[model samples]
Target: MPETSGVPALAVEAPGMEPHPAMKRRAALGLALGALATPALAQAPWPNRPIRLIAPDAPGNGNDITARLLAPQFEAMLGQPMVVDNRPGAGGRIGVEAAWRAAPDGYTFLIGNAGSNGINAAIYKDLPYDLVTGFRPISMLVAGPNVLVVNRSTFPVSDVASLVTMLKARGDGYAYGSGGVGSSAHMSMELFRQRAGFVALHIPYRGTPALAQGLITGDAPVAIVNLVNVMPFIRRGEIAALAVTSLTRWPELPEVPTLDESDYPGFETMAWNGLLAPLGTPEPIVARMHETVQKIATNPMIADRVKLLGGQLVASTPDEFAARIAADVAKWRDVAQRGDIRAE
Candidate 1:
């Protein structure tokens, strides 16, 4: 053995010991780096096949419309098609539960809104999945503004103020229809009743289509529906648009005024739809898909289509989307409790 300066040399006969200190240190470092890379490499590539996007509502609903409009752009960006799966029923619970149970791969996702994500949490006594913790928010596709519409022949009121006056005079027996109990329309009208100081009966249907039919046939004289769902009827002069349920008027409906402007200062009620993946999905994949969705939202063609549907294209960051969902859940839960709203 030789002592060289501050270091000592190892004997060549030493057992289970490397004689080259530099080489030994390099080998150990290399092994550690390799071990770190293995798991990163083992994770499967995202969009390896068509991604499944579930919309709990049936076809023709806003969620379905949003998923379809963004699918083409997502396919182009992700290099795989987005297969829209509509699992309608149970007040939008079927699709949400399906998505919640899916493998936490980024390939499966859900397009959910206040009805399924926020309102359901507020009204449902037993929820199978937790909205805030069970899934990862991807991005908010749009903020859906609803229109307060009434059949032309049944309701003579023109604007929100007049409608309020009519409801007051008509007493509490008047009926208003919605997609279902605890839905945005149902909740918004409850807010309307609170703010306008009127009492109107609520009628919940299985879906919005039936609600729309009720409006058309005068089975239900008044209803609040997404601008997109009710725009065609409004244009046809079948119903009168009292006010939009947003802070500002939608660009597509420039002539229309928002609820805030309709004598109910600061009034706003908008349903939002966003993409979400099951919990435990890789963060990178979520980020990638979010970026793709942002692009789709901003695409000119997509923007045009959304406008026609009376929806604004807003692709918010995942963190912002998640925060909005959390805030809305809390906000609407309070509204539901105050109004004593429950599912029928």
Candidate 2:
């Protein structure tokens, strides 16, 4: 039988065989319906399901806290659940790798920060994903300066100058604690050490809380930690604030001079967290996420909460965030190289 594009050649019917008018009409209607449905299927609305946001740090850490705080607002704006997944390990590389490997269909994103996105990119030579090429910046949620704090009981210094003198006097005999090897805490302290020409052993802990515990218990004499995590202790007089790692003093710790004013001119380092999607995520989705986050950042309640945590709300544009990421990577790359810093 001759073929009729799978219609079976009318079964080799009599030489003049023709499809019945009723059957032809039905076939034409079916074709027309299929054609109409094609565009509808292609244009289905995005985020028809819950979005999985990967926080590349331990629970209660800066990144995880930021993700949890913003998730509700995100869900409200996107009309979908925002599920935060904490996959902490390998100095945040584990979670970041997981996010990078996920499908770029707008359902999976990362709560990237200074540690995972900036310092790690510079120090982790064998990272499974590239910070610049493997992800797209959505928006920067918040930025805060790291505070240089010391154990109130054990640390002899009371200010930046005295701390510098003590560190230089002790050489590598004294040590400082950090959240992790490639963490912002570590890099910030290394930068300060380099500027002050001091040598001190680096003690790496599991997370920010552990680092703070070490300081409180006097196991670690010094540390440069995120302002949010250490602010409460500073207020309680458990940890003494020596200086902030920003060009200018932080509003919350106005009396604590910045490193720039403490002899290290122009010194600055901030710990920031932001949203990022896999590199190939659609631009429309990226734009929508950015705009939604900006709205959340500007909300009175959210803004006030962020301020209480010693952070400044920064709903930066995608381009601006991208540029900041690039600059941070470059700046920390130099610091890491100079300090011979590497993840433990």
Candidate 3:
């Protein structure tokens, strides 16, 4: 053996065995890192990017205004930009679904109306999303009253009592227009008719503006809209408001009697605006949004603007909002069944 080394030749190792000490240390470190990474990912901060608030109606509608009014405040509070996305269609289903299907990461939300939030469940034969389950109730920023308006010439009814008398006399001769078949306007009138114990023909239109136009042109003699829409016309003598559908008379239209106090003692209906987020959004983010909405609604300048526009500040808690939705749903369910109103 020519100068064999002092060390003996080593035996070949098996294919698989314990890794070498240094290699094993590295492998063990990777496993430990992976274990640590999982919880870290779970605990990450919310709203990594801009937050989206979807408005189901068109841009100028009340819900859209509510979202836009609070967007800047939320951006400052949450340290992120708030974007409003208007997805108007199907009496607000498109936007409601947009919010419903958004990622539950607390970044996507909805500013919905009474139609989308309360009456849709009862009126629509089938709905793409469940309001009770698919949404997390955040806050109700504003509550607005819907007023009954009529063409100055047609039908000749001045107040709830007069309207009820006219309906009793004319039966189904008078007609009313609404944004759609399942809209809050439709349901509110339906509820009114049920309470008054009479029936009238309902004409559905593409939007509130179209319905309002129908009233102005005498295409439909009667219609209901937010007091804001009818106020200018009322001032111009184009339309006459019969009554408000809120429990209390609106300050701007204090002379107009509430439907509840006028003819139907318990008659009150409204189309409220509120904020909601997709289900499973972080609670902290929801709380932050609620606070921002309340702050904006209660601001003296904003409150004055809203009052002038015929809207009241709701600023209710999440629990109160949930209760209101439930109460509205129950009330409309009965109205739908009793009025024999169905999806068209």
Task: Indicate which candidate wins on lDDT.
Answer: 2
Best TM-score among the predictions, by candidate number: 2
Clashing pairs in 2: none
Question: Per-residue alpha-carbon lDDT of model 3 for 1-344, expressed as tens digits?
Answer: 34354332333447887556776666667677767877998887766789888999888887888778778878876788999999988778889988888888888888887888888888887888877667888888777788988887876767767766777788556788888887878888877777777767888988777887899999988876777667778878898888898899888888888887885787778778888889888888888788777777767877887777778777889888888888888898899998778776
Measured on C-alpha atoms, candidate 1 has an lDDT of 0.84
lDDT of 3: 0.81
Task: Indicate whether candidate 1 or candidate 2 has the larger lDDT.
Answer: 2
Over 4 Å off, model 3: 1-43
Which lDDT tens digits does candidate 1 get at residues 290-342? 77887777688878877787877888998998998888888788888889987
| Candidate 3 lowest-lDDT run of ten | 3-12
Q: Could you tell which candidate, 1 or 2, scores higher by TM-score?
A: 2
**Higher-scoring candidate on TM-score, 1 or 3:** 1
lDDT of each model, Cα atoms only? 0.84, 0.87, 0.81
Give candidate 1's error at residue 137 in angstroms: 0.8
